[model samples]
Target: MTQQTSGEMRIEKDSLGEIAVPAGHLWGAQTQRSIECFPIGTARFVWRRPVIRAFGILKKSAAIANGELGQLPADKVAMIVKAAQSVIDGDVDEEFPLVVFQTGSGTQSNMNANEVIANLAIRNAGGKLGSKTPINPNDDVNRGQSSNDTFPTAMHIAIVEEISRDLFPAVTQLRDTFERKGRQFDDVVMVGRTHLQDATPVTLQQVFSGWVAQLDEALAAITATLPALYALAIGGTAVGTGINAHPRFGDVTAAKIAAETGHAFISAPNKFAALSAHDAVANTSGAIRTLAGALMKIANDVRWYACGPRAGFNEITIPENEPGSSIMPGKINPTQCEALTMVAVQVFGNDAAVAFAGSQGNFQLNVFKPVMLHNVLESTMLISDACRAFDTFCAKGIEPNRAKIETNLKNSLMLVTALNPHIGYEKSAKIALLAHKEGSSLKEAALNLGFVTEQEFDAWVIPADMTHPLPE
Candidate 1:
């Protein structure tokens, strides 16, 4: 059932027969049908610019490949390429208004791209949008592709491009910021905690460096999956067979995409696995999940360190971006940490969705293409945005409250562990307990207990030496 609209409507036809589409829009019959059938999540498709653009890239590459193989006329190919370029440049992002929930295989969105591009090419060639005269959506634009192959192909393209072009840079920038902070805080010794209790001493540098290392490992894990994402399943038109597609269509299209995008994309050697299962997307998302876990740890630690000026740890200070409370006039909070940690949680949830959807490959086709890829892309962009925001507003502005750090370090009973080498673990434990019980300094506790003289206490309980190895 088409929604009643007050506008000039054009009649368009597909295999399902005629449907009325708005005259001002570029999409045709199939897209119009999808709009009616799945009247859901109208605002949901707006963020899918990357996926739509990936379709444009795939469509353009297909036309080029078809033209090169003498499968499509040069004039038609030219019009399709120009029209597809408009999609790739985001000029026609508004035309692709199909939500992620429309079709599990993203068939509707594939047709949506086909119709929009086909009509654009038709209009470019001085023909009616729905006539399919100078260009046909199925025959010209989607000449050698199917929703089965092209949908996953576009998923890979979007995933690879978004990770490489957006996520990596944002993560790298934040990692570099933490690394620089590590250097700046290298000399600042601080108390370390395990199980939310003081355990030993570590420089603030070590904490920041640990975050850098986690990011490095996560980045490598994500990078390892890109080669798999670069593998395109284009020639497997419907099932795993080439069928109506040209034999070299996948290879030529992958090569064209690689050349255009500056990524080393190739045709998947096993199109069956490529189209049947989205394990590449799942694997990449797993890596992103690890990064999310790291972000959770980093953000939580930052917030804990910046807990309070008087009551909590108060060892570090983050940026004060805004008023932190509704009623409190002078209170500030770790808002960036909260935002980043929330994004990390969201990525974790998205990972679960991606994993579940990726596992739903029934035989030769995974009908869960849109859900799986949608989650992966959403996680990627979320982490990218979160990392950049956290870096700019919080991590980059982080500064050790040196006086507070020294006070905390001096007050930590865990520093008694440093005296273990000289007096033994049992005696060190006694001294720590006594200091805690009596609210006395380690030196006072040791002297009162006759565990060590002032000179011995001073030598053994040096906080600087406790940060790393030292001889007794």
Candidate 2:
């Protein structure tokens, strides 16, 4: 078939039909048909680089497995491996142009990778491009795989790589920053709020400790999902029967991917379970969802604590990265917190889509894989970036307002709870009510009401000691 046309287009044909492809593109007939079909939004596998690289790694492993099984010729394997390495090295990202909303099984994107690698190999061997003679995309490039298995395999590889390389470090750094600040503010006692109402006294360090605990739980949730995510579906070609694929293809391909990524990529014990369901991806998305909620809570707390300099809590100060209002002057805002909170909302939404996609898997394969993986990667990237921003701009620069903290601690009516042991619960409640009604301090109301002497009040209601359990 004649590939090149007048200037910038080429004719390409697949089983379905023929279409005009861009003259310079590495994609072939199937990809061209997808471009003509599915005119969805412009979110072309937003994580294209990582997703493509994962495909590169998958194809390379497949070539090695096929070669070892005597299914592919040595020279063809060599050409495929070398070309796939370039994909892994991020050399041909421009070639994969399909969006995430395409075919339910991600076949279009898989074929896109196959065609590109096949073209690269042919070109390197000094053959005419677009000529699928010696290196057929389906036969040579995707030797022992189906989109059903390969797409999910790529999804797992990309998610694991991103979490290990990006999300873990950013979240760990943010947690460390919170802990460091916790130590710095350990001695500064402030009024604690419950249900957004003044409740009791607590050290600023203790408040930050809560944030640290939230992140700790989030990190643990993510780490726990790794074993499931490492289970790849590569060997379960077509419908998890290893049909048309070597018996050892799954084991060998998984080992090669593990070696390439320096991570443990394991073959699924049950191919049917791995192929028919995406419980692993769903579980990972749930963990990420929990992380998003945790970060959102932390960000909201920071913004609330730094609400106002004169009217709000004013107990803590966060780094103000931008102006709070368009018209208000000298009004710095917690921009990092705002940005992180927005990302958290987005993750929440993405998790819903991922969970729905996971549940949509029929008997053999999940058609919503592209959308599921797309949402997962988007959530990962957003959370990772938000964590870094929060650590750099907000958590690290946070400082305590000692004067405000001391003033609030001294005037809080809730501190009267300490008098319960010395006097009685009934009498302490009376004094607290009196203090609030008369707009007087707890100590003054107690003194005026003759509940306790100043000496006794001072001895019983110690703010520092009230923060935690008494001596014994």
Instruction: In candidate 2, list every pair of residues with a backbone clash.
Output: 104-367
The TM-score of predicted model 1 comes to 0.97
Candidate 2 yields a Cα-based lDDT of: 0.90
Tens digit of per-residue lDDT, candidate 2, span 1-472: 1223457877777786667877787889898777768778888875778899899999999998899989999999999999999999988888888877899899999999999999899889988767886799998899889999999999999999999999999999999999999998799988889998888898989988999999999989999999998999999989999899889999999999999999999898888778778989999999999999999999999989888888988888887677778898898877888899999999999999999989997898888899989999999999999999889988999999899888889989999989998899999999999999999999999999998999999899998888998677
> Which residue pairs show collisions in model 1?
none
- Write down the TM-score of every candidate: 0.97, 0.97
| 130-237 per-residue lDDT for model 1 (tens digits) | 999889999899898999999999999989999999999999999999999999999999999999999799999999999999999999999998888989989998
Quote the positional error of residue 14 for candidate 2 in Å. 1.8
After superposition, which runs of candidate 1 have C-alpha atoms over 4 Å from their true positions?
A: 1-4
Q: Cα RMSD (Å) between model 1 and the true structure?
A: 1.7
